[model samples]
Target: MAMIEDAGRRRALRTLTAGALAAGGGLLSVRAFAGGLATVNMQLGWVPGGNQVGEVVAKRLGYYEKEGIDFHIQPGGPNIDGVAIVASGRFQTGEISSSPSIMLAVSEGLPIKCIAVGLQQHPYTFFSLKKAPIRSPQDMIGKRIGIQSTGMVLLRALLAKHKIPENQVKIVPIGADMMPLVAGQVDAVTGWQTNTTALKPLGADRVDLRLWDTGVRLYALPYYATTSMLKEHPETVQGFLRATARGWMYANQNRDQAIDMLVKDYPNLNRADERVAIDSLMHYAFDQTTQTQGWGAMDAAVWEEQIAMYGQLGQFRAAQPKVDDVMTLDVLKATHSSRLKV
Candidate 1:
């Protein structure tokens, strides 16, 4: 919750000096001063990192306006399930974790489809006490580990990959707080740097071993949408993606400026320790995931393997749907925000 220093402001001013206006500056004008606006409510996940950057950037740069999609950014809660919110029509646009969601929803007859994947690489890390003598994923065997929820995507993925049965290990739901690990209530915790950043104030110094580093080759955060949504208004969705794409590009291009804006706007955000959360996102950039597949593409093999894993874990009763059919590249390619090919 440290205040954004004046030096950060100077950095932002210097950064903006390079580009007076954003790439799609013209799209923001007109259709305002005014009434009759189409309302779009977007939901946020528990933490703000790579997943939240697109919406934050798009909102700041008016890329939503460029696409003619009026959006209102709504903060998500701790216990609120993102997929349930989206399925219930509580929000028009939002991001959610991939595993145990898309496939399960499709079988249950939900009209949701993954639009874009935000995290090319995941940020979830398994942390243990420095003196616990734990070094790697194998060390976690027969140990009680902490995670946010029982069905949390990362924890389940880790368990399945290690060939460790839940019966052998106790899974405790930490719910976005990792201080219990420091207090010895839990041996290791499942969380991102965002949660850990908040823990700095509590004097909990822990190391994170990025759990995805161990054999789990999968996509983490993917944007979802309903078929009915796309069919009713293709243009609006396309514009939203275009703006989202530009916002991501802008945010990546200008990190210091964006971080300054984020810390300044959300004063409760722990600024002193934000470097970990901020710098960890460097791995997710324009080229690796987005440019390779036009912002929201997933490999069929990866998707199928994930669903099959969910089935194996008994996370779902029946086989999941063909994810290749659920996710579409038509809209992203049509928008062509940049010259990237997928």
Candidate 2:
């Protein structure tokens, strides 16, 4: 548990370091193209798994290649600072776990902006047993909430939204697991609802209270690039989004093939676990909004809501970043036609 939390802290520090460097000095401007094909290394905030099924499916099917992109997936671990790597111009793009990260980075004057969202609604949820259920924010009162130290802000946001007094809920520092809750150490635990592997131990007794449903709507799996990349090569970004969207569309239509491609690409993953996880994962990836607006769809209004919420939480030490400063819908607008088809 300590190791997992420590890894999260180290990743945050890396993101902060990149932002500080951007504010104090400047980030290098890397060329968008390499040789004949446009090279793109997508840095992930955590180890590659079911969250990246679409990307794996896309790469396996040569979707990126057809789009004139030599795409590479750079797995991020506790030691690797994916955001910093992208900000430093060492990588072409990055995708983080949550939307707050983009806002936090931009607030610190990081030279990056989110271009598209992978999951329209965040899957971060609070899990509890049926015996002592916590189905809503209000139910959290008087209950021991097991969460990672880094996720304190989310707990705070939920409390604030529901007008629950902070002191009512007991905060139990725990890792990203169900053990603490299973051992009766805490009443509830925090993790992504889409991670079937992690949620398995909790059994059928598990009850979910998602953060997004609590009125703290947040985008997850947001893709970002340096401000320079957006300015210098907008076309490249558009191409990347187009191919990626197609990949997700394909995965949604053909689940079996997507899982096969995923397991083939990354041998370490359990085929059975990933197979079950993708059902929950895809549910968040494509909702009614995606049915109309297409995959990677995001709203500026939602970004504004998140910024305001985080602002109220005092998460931003520097100047509060405008919605435009954190994200741009230009790429989404440009690829609207193809995105709609997907």
Candidate 3:
């Protein structure tokens, strides 16, 4: 589900407050704004870095301003509950690290829906050295696999998909460090392929086996907003998608300039590391589907597949959520023409 460091945090349901309600015609309602350009505060599930390069590009280039949006990004960390914060109507929108997070939240009655996907395929993968390679799910048998506690569900899903008994492999709970593999404490480690800085120590001998390749099929970097905001002000969501698409299209064409702007917006980011990371990030952002449907494209079939997989794994707390409960394509359809064509 959640791939970030604070994955253990409980996702308590937050009720919308009076401040979020607008009185219209003597009835309480949720409005995009009171007056002037609407502010779109995007809450993130993790600290901003290369993952937010497109939004950074849009903000820097005035794409959001051109769309009449006063855009701001609220950074998330271990202590932050971004999903609950947005569900409370304190923020207009949110972007999470994984797609199943939205499904799991919706299953628990969270008033959120995924509007668009940032990456076509998930980049989460298993890494091992060539000497002791885990080239496939079958290779994990009788081997020590180091993973984060929150990622245990993912590992379980992978094993289940392959029809391999869980007891055949040894799962070692480790932090985000790749040191366990380097020190021979574990035979393999799990992390995103886009994290070039962390993967640097693994060197050229590193072998990768993506979770998607194992038939897990999860999405990364999904954009979502509260259900009320979607029902009340779809146009605002459309505007955000249009501008954000332009930013990603621009980044795809102009890598060097995009990285320069990204590092400028977030001063702490190293230009060299991000420059290397963006190349890998773009591969997941755009693909054959993006080329035909434009940026931020998603397929309902994929969502259905994800729901079925997660349900079969017993990841849902209550009844399994429907695909419509977790996502919608209305905004994508409305902004199709405006989104940049790859």
Tens-place lDDT per residue, model 1, 158-247, is 766887675777777776676778778777876654444655633544656775577665566677766756667677677677777777
Model 3: how far is 38 from its true place, Å?
A: 1.0
Q: Write the per-residue lDDT of candidate 3 for residues 1-342, one digit (tens) a residue.
A: 423222233424323344345422211122455356778989999999999989988988989888888788899987677887787678889999999889888887778999999999999999999999999999999999999987898998899888999999999989998999999999999999999999999999999999999998889999999898898878888888888998898898899999999988899999999999999999999998888788888889899998998888778767899999999999998988877552
Off by over 4 Å in 1: 1-38, 45-51, 78-82, 88-90, 151-157, 165-167, 170-175, 193-196, 199-207, 263-267, 273-276, 285-287, 336-342
Top-TM-score structure, candidate number: 3
TM-score pick, better of 2 and 3? 3
Q: Model 3 — TM-score against the truth?
A: 0.92
Model 2 lDDT-worst window of ten: 1-10
Off by over 4 Å in 2: 1-35
Worst 10 residues of 3 by lDDT: 22-31
lDDT of 3: 0.86
